[model samples]
Target chain A: MSLNVVSLVSVGRHPQSGRARRADQDGRAVELGLKLVAKALSVVHVGDPDDPVLRQYAGMGLPSMTILKQDKSIDAVPILSQFLQQEKIDIVLTGVRAESGESSGMVPYLLAHALGWPVVARVADIVSVKDGEAQVLLALPRGQRRAVSVKLPFIASVDHAAEIARQSAFALGLRASIESVESVGEVDRIRVDWQESVAKSRPKRLKTVKAKTAAERFKAATAKPEGGTGKVMKNETPKEKARAIFDLLLEEKVIR
Target chain B: MSNVSSLGISSLGIVRRDPRKEWIARNRLHPLYHEVINEGLGSVVGPSGLIRKNPHQIGFIGPNGIKRIDRLKGNGADTSNKRHGSAQEVVLPLHVVTTPDFYLVVVPDLVGGRLSSHDKDILGLAHALQGGMEGNGAVVAVCFGDVKETQFDLAGVDRLIHLTGTEFEGFTPEARVAALVQIDTQLAPQHWLFPDSIHGGTDLGSRLAASLGERPATQAWQVIPEKVVCRGAGGSLDIARQTPRIVMVLEECGNAIDETRHEVLPISVDALEIQSAHLIDHGQVAVDPNEIPLAEAEFIVSAGNGIHNWAQYHQTAQALGATEGASRVAVDDGFMPRFRQVGASGTWVTARVYLAVGISGAIQHMQGIGQCEKIIAINTDAGCDMVKRSHLSVIDDSDVILSELMQLAQEYGVNDKPSQENSPEESQNVA
Candidate 1:
């Protein structure tokens, strides 16, 4: 049976330049969807149809994309859920979090709750789909992975561990058609009270000395900071040096 | 005659001064002044019978043969004596909440059955919120599955709800969320704090928030009772909003509690309605070290252009069980894959230990490893930037070090099995 795979796309702000670009995880989601159902993959966006960033995602060999043209103040959850239900999408793919707006990473969960479907988060890959179930790999901390199986009609959030999105082709993106649809969206009321400003860099927590006595305080103040210059082994034999390195590896528990 | 009498008395341990001698010593030009005035004869009792102490006589001779006075009044001496004795364990005061007026619930991501640093930070934030409000508010830590953390009291947990069951173990977010929902109904905490980390905290917290239908503050760095400052727009913009019921906090949001201990009172829910799980977990997959991404790998062995024997470098990395990485120059030379390149231009790595072989660290390469905890550099040039940044540097040829390291790893693997067997034999011999 052919799978109805849909990838949600969003305009991303470059972290360094703060310019409009294709969202990293969303592009990966599209890449994964393309790998799964190549010709049948449908790309959907909830924001402006004229967002030039949308074309960059199309540049990854997409034939066309659908846009539910809406305003920034409106919530995309209701509109996207409605569209997904109407289309009867078997597999819905999205980035773990949007690179714009609140970036709360609640879209998939909220959508899953609304549709009564299970949502797999931080998915590294979908290994296979068989017997109305898909075998998925979830990314864990420190390069670990967990295998899980969820029934179809589920939502999966593509993780950074997934295969990176292919580079965009300018000509292919220009040739792809962008379909625009006017969808009614609810204005987010709770966000009206929020105050937004440029993020300030957080101060690094310094190692504090809670000295009880004057002598202890003096020693704390006079003590040299740790780990400044490294220990260089110049005259040691190769065996000794290798032993030192091996000891550190053992200390770090990197070796089994 | 008086000096002889005084010397006789001095032999009996009575410090009696001869008056005539003191007078002669006071008269500097007297003939016997040199004999009376010795090195330590600085102070003497007056005829009025008052005892006198010489300031010069109190101090001992220094290394330079000059007397040095200790102005600390022997406090330094007492401290030195204490240092030589056994060290004392410092115990912090306990903070108890008898009748909690409210609750600030915290769900820590106890990775590997222990409290991670991120979990401690969130617990700290929970206590800060509890302190900010009026009345006694208890910080409740709801831990799922096995707990190896014994310092929950030190981590500022006033109450603990440890849910240990097979249902709550290993990738069971659905069951865990159900338990949290039950706790919410029971305690009705004022706020819920979770570490905004990838280690199941964010996932569990988000799941709970969705089920509770409460909008949560994600990536919150600064939080107060009245307001919360969260990083939005992919950490570029700060959004200050009214304090929400659920808050997912970033690391370093508040200081970990070190000054006081807590009760760590164990609590439990009456009954939890665990929902049937739709997702089935198959446990963790065994991932090869080489297949792991360079950015996420905890241990990396990176090579550079100085490596002539690429096969040996790969063998060393394999033996060390480390992910392979490469310097930009190595990637440019087509000796390694582009994804293996580590620099500002390539992937930034946050490995715990980074072992660089022959990489004369470029500025970009240094930038990529900025978050690495320990770096070991093996290079011929001791003055290279990599050596300067590394915790341990070996000035030698890369080929020699790599070969030796590989041999050491192989021998260690061989030695481990025998050591385990020998331990049993040695214990039997002792018996």
Candidate 2:
């Protein structure tokens, strides 16, 4: 039997503006799902389908998406986990994080915990799937990639290094329809008394230096006024030049 | 790529430069410095001539209007040093180390099998937290496996708890989580701190948070007695945990305090038994030990995208006996491995001296080398960001300068090879 694959989608924010927009990563996850399962891929979302921001994602290749319409008070993890369990999904894919809101990047982990499946984060690309196992290339920092294989019934979060998602076609976006399903699950009761306020930039930290008197304090305060004093050697002896550099290394504690 | 030769002949290949003056001259502000001024936070210069950071004053307004004591300029009126009256002293019972209130769990780098600088920073933070509680709190350093307590500087720790067992070894997430969870159950520390130094820290922290049913703050930078200052979404977030049990993953806090002040005390060892999870067979990737000597090496030669010949850079590093590092660009271009990349997302370097080659200093890269005592920049562009951060800037072809430096080292018999005294086996935990 073919693998029952599901790709989770969400409205991502613009990188700079933090405005609600189509999430590029979710689209990439959809792309990966489509490559694996072709047209049989199921796209699921737990938020409102009417949230116009999701249209940008709907236009990117996928013809339809399922919205498990949930209340703001309801937690999405248990609902999604139960839904995936009911569908008996063999593989699940999602973006590493949502670009806005509670962008804790905890959904994948929480979902994996709920479903009792291992999660592979920062996946660059899916290599292949055969006999209840999937080969994937994991994205590491500094543009490096590593190959890792995971057993079936696992969750994978797409990284930015994944393929650039296909552009949203205006016509297709207009034609795409979102399927809404009623959410049935217990709401998270852990009260997070959020003191929502405009965040201010962190204050600069001044390194504390012991100054007995005001003179030393003033001098220390006005430090680094002079930029780096550089030397250009034209007719200096190699020994003299090497000695100078060696002194610098010693002074800097690079060489003991 | 041949842009180095494009400079006019009137200018000599090398020239003197002042980074701060150059920044002002070019009207390009250093991102960090600019943020300081933009935030209306007064800038403070340290004795080392580097700008120092000012921590946020936690939830209190002083009686005086000044938010910072450093900003106050004055000579205090001195009451004579001699005591006027008989010393009126209030007698109090001496403080004693007992059950730990604060726990500093140094998670080993599962892949590298070593301790990271951030782990030391977490220890320092735990020390500070313990002190803030007026010597009422005790600190315990927890390590998995047969890690030698001497590997770390346990200055502030009242007791060291070593989980001595072979099962603690290996890169299995299950084993680590089980060990930490079991420790938490046993100790029940009021506060738990984990250093977010390696890739595995986040996973361990989150899993612990989940199992404990508490949301842990990641990238925490500062700690007060009760609250932890964390890097919040878009800014700084101060989180106060109502429950006594709190877990936090700390960022690069630097080796601020001296580690050698306190004498080593006897540590209390606790043997923990954890249930092993089913293992999966898979391939693993390892970083070249010689490439990025972040914590161990004193001298580092780093390459940037402007490097025309990557092999020459490596040769020069070998000649000088210095560890090789790369900017994000060099690593991205596959000229260097991911582990060799030095920047915010990569490894934070605490080397004594850093030599940047053909690299434009990006803020991300600068963040990593914040603790380097001296930075020497060689770039074609004199006004490049990297040059501005360096104590010395060579405005010439880096390839030529590097070759000349290498020749000079050979002639002088510098022989500054990588230190054999510091090896992976020792795994220096004290940064």
Candidate 3:
């Protein structure tokens, strides 16, 4: 027996300009994350049957996926919790962070507590499991690693490193089916202590450092750091020499 | 150790979400926080159904190596918050010592393969606790302080121990628990508290439970004097059993009190010196309360997958001057960052004009954006869920209707300006 668990997806609206002009950004991340989830769960359900995520897998005649529909007003956490209990789910897995609202980074924690399941955050890999417990990898700072053992019927937040999630090609993206669900309770906005949204904008940090020539864009891209060759100001006095060194350092960010 | 005799059983564990290793202790087996890794207490089976004798022991751990906070400049900040004006008070890092088996905390240095002085301090603490003793363990932390913008002070403690090292920067969940396990076994405290940051509760809670011999709970509420009560679910056990007497802080429910005091004394090893901390510059912008606050917003509109070609909806957004988004589509398309997506990821928005243009109303996509006073959906298919769920369904083709609206807008003269609507002052962000 398997739990008809549903993968709840959510998004945040851009605080300022409400226009999305690119393609495949969500498709790639979602599709990749979905493949990772599939490797861990026995029965996976989705909220939107028509989602591009479902279509991606349709060609491979991949495993069955279900969708639940309701008034958009429904509070997902409660809805998901009730569904998990109702379906007797063994566990739930979601991303360490979603791209949208309340970026408070509270969902996985809240849901695990709400569903009464253990949660593993930013898990890199699920090593193995047989009798309720499992050994998993929690990627550490840098490329370092650590091995953690925990019990099952728990929640885990997957990191991009968990595994290279698979892709659903053109063929598989077609045969997915859309399932219908009945209406449920809807969660309305709780106007207590509203969080004001900061207008969102991407920070401009990229610097164009090309060695003077537009035609050499490709060459410049492949170029390595050109080692500087300059004599040390060892013979000069401390104060005068220090001033020159500081100026050079500022040009290269070698010093503040 | 202030009060060890009053120790009660509290299960503290990060949500254990490893989908693989199948050990009996792994079966909801909570790892100890402080003592297990320090002296090699081995392991034990708990009433929660975890039985582990695993050899991956946490050896002695402590902070070592004194970094005298440039005594000259430090002497001034130590007296008062006046002379330094904008600078925060300097506090030192007071960590117990440890060895390689003890796991050091290294930040950028560790990644770059250079161990910092703190890393060596970790070895010192571990070596001292280990005292030529074999096996892995961790130093116990009865209490620690926030060393924000400060020097690590060794004032007011029994002994100055060091297990400082480069490996001890921010630790992975496994390493954190590995180090904590030793401390848990050695010193089980009655009153336990953790940093109220995002990284703490997620894994730290679960690790504490496994080490401390108690079922730890996350997001503690009111501490009823002697007893600490927490609010969280204890997953895995089908049977109900009360393994009582422990306290934990709840999540996002309360503001964490700044804990900036802990005593330290240099035993035979001189002072527990602290190096200068990374400088910080902070500022705040005030928001005028009398604005078109989100709560007071009468009309709210959200976009989703239904709006295929954005150009088609230009006139629609312009006509209504509504904030637009998707059920996870526009967000991924770079039309916006994922933060703006309308489902489980984005804000839970609700207002008067809830319009779903070309949105399929997927659950994840809908959860964040679906709420509004009135939802009007325009899609070609009457059968689509968007048509069924919206307050008003426009069955005409999206391209046709949007284009028609755009033409009408140009004819009507209010096309290019979104500023013509309601209040110009409302256009600003949360600030």
Index of the highest-TM-score prediction: 1
Ranking by TM-score: 1, 2, 3
For candidate 1, write residues A117-153 as lDDT tens digits.
Answer: 8889999999999989999999998888999999998
Residue B429 in model 3: lDDT: 16
| lDDT for each candidate structure | 0.86, 0.63, 0.41
Worst 10 residues of 1 chain A by lDDT: A223-232
Candidate 3 Cα deviation (angstroms), residue B403:
71
Weakest 10 consecutive residues, lDDT, candidate 3 chain B?
Answer: B278-287
Better of 1 and 2 by lDDT: 1
lDDT of 3 at B283: 15
lDDT of 1 by residue, B1-431 (tens): 12321222345433354666645644668886665544344557778988676775655433234554544322233323233222446578999999899999999989878988888888888888888899999999999998899999999999999998899888998899889999999999999999999998888888888889999999999999999999999889999999999999998888888889999998878877787898999999866776777888999999997799877887678778788888988888777767778999999999999999999899999999999999999999988899988999999999999999999899877233322221222123221
Q: lDDT tens digits, residues B126-178, model 3?
A: 22333333554332222122123122233212233233443334443444444
lDDT tens digits by residue: candidate 3, A96-116: 544433232355666666765
Instruction: Please give me the DockQ of candidate 2 compared with the native complex.
Output: 0.08
Alpha-carbon error at B424 in model 3, in Å?
61
Candidate 1 wrong stretches, greater than 4 Å:
A203-209, A227-248, B1-78, B81-87, B291-293, B304-308, B326-348, B356-370, B375-401, B404-431
Residue A25, model 2: lDDT of 81
Estimate the Cα RMSD of every predicted model relative to the unseen true structure. Answer: 10.6, 19.6, 30.5
